[model samples]
Target: MLAAGRGYMEERETGKQEAVASVREIFGLSGPLYLTAVDWENSHHRRSVAASLVQGVYILERDRQQKRQGHQSHASPWWNFFHFQLISPLIDDVDFSIFGAIYEYNSSVFEHNAPKYVIAFRGTLNKPDSRLRDLKLDIQAIRSKLHQSSRFQLAMQAVQDLVAVVGTANIWLAGHSLGSAIALLSGKNMTKLNYPIETYLFNPPFFSLPIECISNPKVKHGIRIARSVVKAGIAVAVKGQHHSSQKDDSFFVLSDWVPYLFVNPADHICSEYIGYFEHRKKMKEVGATKIERLATQNSIGNMIFGVCVRDCEPLHLLPSAYLTINMSQTPDFKRAHGIHQWWDPSFDGQSELHLFR
Candidate 1:
């Protein structure tokens, strides 16, 4: 009995260690703005601030690696076709640490292709302060405060500046976890404003519509009307602009750029039931869906009491090409969720890179 007890304790310790390591890797990749002291009060203008933050000491290694990847002979064909440049910076506020990266590509080899940009967002940190910070963000997320979130706002500013300089329909976006949520919301909002860009959502959270949207019909209706108005305005403003040729897929042709969604079926945050029907269909197109309805049902029940109260169906979130990573041997919960698991270097070989961009 004593031996068994010792073994159990050891197992628990190992699990805790793994959890810590997983979270640490995410913060490390996000760089040191949240890890170190940040001068929030006297921060420079958004453009200069973003540029300076990308030069942070901690992020240098990743920048170096990205550059090295660009020079690799066996790099993706996509890389060979265009010249890629990157800028990453952590934008910190009182509530959240938002990590943003921009990749600029110029089709030097191909004329009339025009320059393009890819914006990436890093998920939440696992630090002590981040835990406290998440308390407020959790509430805000439940409220679906996309426009109100400082992190979301900062991301928009970066995109807006880039759009002005490089122009539209040439931008792509990517993010994981909380960052994914922000990216989806931002992409949706931007599309309504006629600045449609392709996006990649990596393990997006389950609560796409927010609990508040479910509870308050008026708020939901108001948001819908507002978006419709924005879309109408955009259509009028860009009426004479040249439209790009649609991609091959019927589902992808709905938007300007095809959004690619990378997820693990076992991921608690992004299982089969989490997103809309169109999203599930896209996931099916890429790979098999993992059924963990009991876990998902329980998770949803816990997150929003509003779901229980409301009889009507909640609104669907962004639609994209869903790519699921298969891990039959590992526990569904263990293999799924968490920012680091999906993109960590340790699992690079395991990642399904061929299917989606």
Candidate 2:
């Protein structure tokens, strides 16, 4: 198990180093990977729009190809230029895009470390409607074991195949935004399959579902009621499950490998969902359903008093960090949510003071 301090340091370095390589290898994207990761507008609006449209189509086609083949594409999009596969194709008929990056662990050189594998999932690039559809699919899968979508099914196959080939112990899972959620689900599924995995998640959304009602005054009442029900249900469902402790013999034990979660302070996915989940897990152990209810009620009350005052802070005690990505350049709150924001160069590279206990 990785200690909290060491894990945080290792995660930051791994992210910085891998972000450069993963961006270039996974996508045939050029220039800065962070720039393409977000829909940042340049002076030429037409070119940006056209490029985004083209990228959207490209991503969807890749998703389709992986599904049709029942695994990742046989010939990676990088193969013609690079003349090699980053990840080997595992299944003949699985779904979802699961790319493998071959690297040597101990060696600094790409070839020297010989055969270490880092499996990565790409984030969303499609239009909002398509993204939302995928989000719902993932949510349904998580909420119900019987309702496995192509993404869930294929992710399991991919991880299982890789674990068989590489052996389970040292394998790493990485992803951003939507991809982060996929990686998490895949890791959780892998755990149940008796394969422990190390995961690095960037800007993973809380529950990975859109909270449209959170901001809409007309829908606030309904949102609160829905949230209350969800709070109670999660409190009941996840009670007695220790999220950080690895000592459990049960299925949900996170003991096998440490997870490194990176997000901005304002990221709703990490702060809100992660916080809520952590709070509930603690309550479950103590059999404190009343406290859980009070916490949920208090959060709702705070939101009503002044929505902006309610900051969805991530679980400070978890191995989490605030990436100080400058947001002044882009005023859109939506853009601030991207993992790309954390990689910006303007801010000091280090994460804020450790909040985890």
Candidate 3:
């Protein structure tokens, strides 16, 4: 994995590439780690933010090692080849750094192309006033991560910025909680704008869309494309059970993604409070198709393309120190239920992604 992420950039770009490579090392997380980085704020200048649907991935066993894995591939060629073919281009697409992947054990290596632009976003729910902070975020000490940028915002920014740097561009949206929702939404926005988009939704929340796009073309377009995820059954989504008020937290599904992942129960409201200050009143959301309906639909696309990606419990959520969940029972998987957007092997290997960038 280090070799794949290290020195990935050109002669002059090595510094940035290495920085991304060392993310896990700097953070000191245990087990496999997945992270995203992006540059936003500039995207709206020529393009809207683009979420990196995918990012670097890793797996940890026993010793709980957080790094070092290139040696494992020596045992298998397919895994080696998978590593070379898939991972070599992670800067541009998915990287084969993790185990159990077709590319994880690839053999051949290709000449590198242009250096991939990195991005970062701020997904932590940080607010000045204690009253303004989301309880979930505060509990996670996300408020303390002042230096950490929002992966969701950064990924969208990266999508928009990469266009200026990369001749061709694609949006890869992946993340946990808010980051995941932002990535999915950002991809939808790109779809509407008619940009070259290949979205990678990871643990994306079946969140309620903001009311700002009620009449916007981008909003409408994103909704339509998002519906496609539903049709494909790739999205473990949730719809607002109560339509009366613009702000409702009721869920419509109990099965599918959220429950399967077994993320902290309080993850459900992480958005409600996180999006605070911006939409304190609990804004209205618009979706082409209800999240609940997508749950029941048995489409060939979902069954065939969609992989049941989650384990009964996420490796990160197993301990309370890392994540303390406040569970609330509800039918709506998206609302007040950390059920819809989740990571795991059930939906394929997207479980480890942190789309905040």
Candidate 4:
């Protein structure tokens, strides 16, 4: 994908240039992809946001810290402090030089191969702990934390920049877990705005995205404007859950991804209720919504989401609503923990995917 050419992106004689081009090429098969990393910008357990211009795809990972877990100076001060950077090894898994360039691989991508000039965007605090992240459903303290969310906003800005830079005619996005949800939001938003940024979402949490916000006609109109080329594009979502998923399946959307992606091994809609239907039912019996909403505006929304957020209105409804999609399931092999990494040696970008939908 990478070649010695002085096109739109500033060309470099070094192999590093080839790598970024390769990433761009792979993701760009769909469009000039941009991946922004963040747990919606809530708390400390955030993974670093690293976006590789892999082929036509822009892979973004977020480095986040654990919620509720207190800190003196910082949680991961000694470490890289970014969950996104920790997954650096994945950079080797893809052929970023596929961007019409003669590509080469090396340590530079592992060390410091990011674009020389990065345009950083600001994060927002939309809601507090409305999206649930735990099984215990213990969000009493979390409610006091999350004040707002800045994940989508920050990602949107980064994506806009990437679009301007590569100016791809197509677009696609893919990610796992929370990253997956973010990708869908960004992709759907861009599409709605008429940006024509097609998307490829892998294992996104249906429970996290704000349906109301995404479906808002205003947001849709915004996306329709930036969209140049027009194709519903491909969509994919991967999912698997444990006993909690009574039906042993997930939901689906018409976007060309897995019908639904599972977050916990237990159930497909774990984040919908407070904790357990019985337990949350009891909480609702009291006054959980009022408390949760109050907490949402308390910690700037960031603090609440970093801890507990499933109690909020739209976030709590994510899993349930997504559970309603018509999905076509694919058989998948169960592997160990690091199986999700991009460079897991045997990681197959095309293989693990279920594109039939």
Please tell me which predicted candidate would have the highest lDDT against the true structure.
1
Expressed as tens digits, the lDDT of each residue in 45-99 for candidate 1 is: 1111222222221122222322323433121221222244555554557643435
Model 1 CA deviation exceeding 4 Å by range: 1-85, 88-90, 95-98, 105-115, 208-258, 272-275, 278-316, 319-329, 332-334, 339-357
lDDT tens digits, residue span 1-357, model 4:
001011212212365422222221222232211222223232111111222222111112111111212332121221122222211212211221111111112223332322222222111111122122211112321232111334344456556666666543422343333334444445544543445443332223323222123346566333332120111110010111112232322221223322222222222323222222222233345555333222221222322233322223232222221221112231321211111222222222222222211
Comparing 1 with 3 on lDDT, the higher-scoring candidate is 1
The candidate, 1 or 4, that scores higher on TM-score is 1
> Each prediction's Cα lDDT score?
0.42, 0.41, 0.27, 0.26
- Kindly give the stretch of ten consecutive residues in candidate 2 with the minimal lDDT sum: 1-10
Number of the candidate with higher lDDT, 1 or 2: 1
Query: Which residue pairs in candidate 2 have backbone atoms (N, alpha carbon, C) closer than 3 angstroms, thus clashing?
Result: 70-93, 70-94, 86-100, 104-113, 205-269, 206-269, 246-255, 316-356, 317-357
lDDT of 3 at 23: 23
Candidate 4 versus the native: TM-score?
Answer: 0.28
Using lDDT, rank the candidates from best to worst.
Answer: 1, 2, 3, 4
lDDT of candidate 3 over 92-124, digit per residue (tens) = 122211211112112244313212332222122
Q: Measured by TM-score, how close is model 2 to the native structure? A: 0.48
